[model samples]
Each structure stands twice: as C-alpha cells, then as structure tokens.
Target: MSDVSRLADRLQRVLARAQEERTERDELVDGPDGTECAWAAHERDQMWKAVNALRADDGRPSIPLDDIVQVERQAAGHSDYSRKFALYCAELAQK
Candidate 1:
C-alpha cells in the first residue's frame, strides 16, 4: 500500500479509538487537572500529525486550520451527549 494511504489508515484508527473512549466515559472523563481531556487532545494531535506526514508539500505534520469542516456530538445511550469533533480534509479542486 502507498505510504499516504497507510498513514491515513493509522490516523483513522486513532480517531476511532479516541471516540470510543469518550463514548464509554460519557463526558465525565475529565480529571481534576484534566488529564483525560489532555490525553484526548494529545491523541487528536497525533492523528493530525499522521495526516500531515502523508502530505508532500511540507515535512512538518500539520493540518490546515481551514480544512476543518464540521464537528459532531454523539450520545452513548445516556443522559448527556459527548462531543465528537470531525475534521474534514479539504480536497484539491482542479481548475
């Protein structure tokens, strides 16, 4: 498989795992110092890095600030819903 495809797959998995954990915790995953929240953010950063690695323009891993399309929140069959941010990558349009 191509390197970009492989990296994308890994990012997808990381995102999925973070979502699953947040679902199970039901938004009460935050600790006093917000360790849980921090961990989630870290995972998200790693996922972004994986995506950036696939890009050829720059060597540094980064997601364009404008590429984010939407964010969704889901409930895990509980009283409150958990936030599930979905960042959509912008596609190159042919002129």
Candidate 2:
C-alpha cells in the first residue's frame, strides 16, 4: 500500500483499540507489579493490530507505537476519541 494508506491503517488500529477503552485512564492495565514490561509489550502490540491488515504480499517494516501520548492527546471529542476520529478518517478515505 502507499505510505498514506499505511499510515491511515495504523491510525485506525490504534484508534479502534483506544476507543474500546474510552473511559479508561492512562494508568497501566493493572496495578504496579512485575507486569509493567508485559503491559507495555501488550500495549505496543495492541497499537499495531493493522501491521498485517494490508495485502499479504506487501512486505514492510512493522509500524511501532513510539509515543502513545500523541494518541492520548487526541482523545477529545463528543462520544469518544477513536470512535469519532475513526469515522472521520473512514469518510475521508472513501472520498
């Protein structure tokens, strides 16, 4: 896929995951413990669900969730962040 499409797909994956936890805070999935590394890994995986959503033949570097704060800052809209933004991007992509 083109670079633009790749970025859109990546954002969609991240947004979808975020929307699922709309009411959730920025805290870890669980309390402080030995799961910090595991939790971080899981979060990174969740944020890249679209890494393979493209064509199977399209081999490319996996997208990484470098800074989650960038996404968190966008969680501001009626209803929810991803829910609304995802819808907007979907609309734009279709046009």
Which candidate number maximizes lDDT?
Answer: 2
C-alpha positional error of residue 33 in candidate 2 after TM-score superposition, expressed in Å: 17
Residue pairs with colliding backbones in model 1 are: none
lDDT of 2 by residue, 1-95 (tens): 76656556666677566546644444445422334334344543454444333322365433334323234335435566554444334323333
* Candidate 2 lDDT score at position 23: 48
Per-prediction TM-score, please? 0.36, 0.32
TM-score of 2: 0.32
Off by over 4 Å in 1: 28-46, 52-58, 70-95
Show the lowest summed lDDT stretch of 10 residues, model 1: 86-95
RMSD of each: 8.2, 8.0
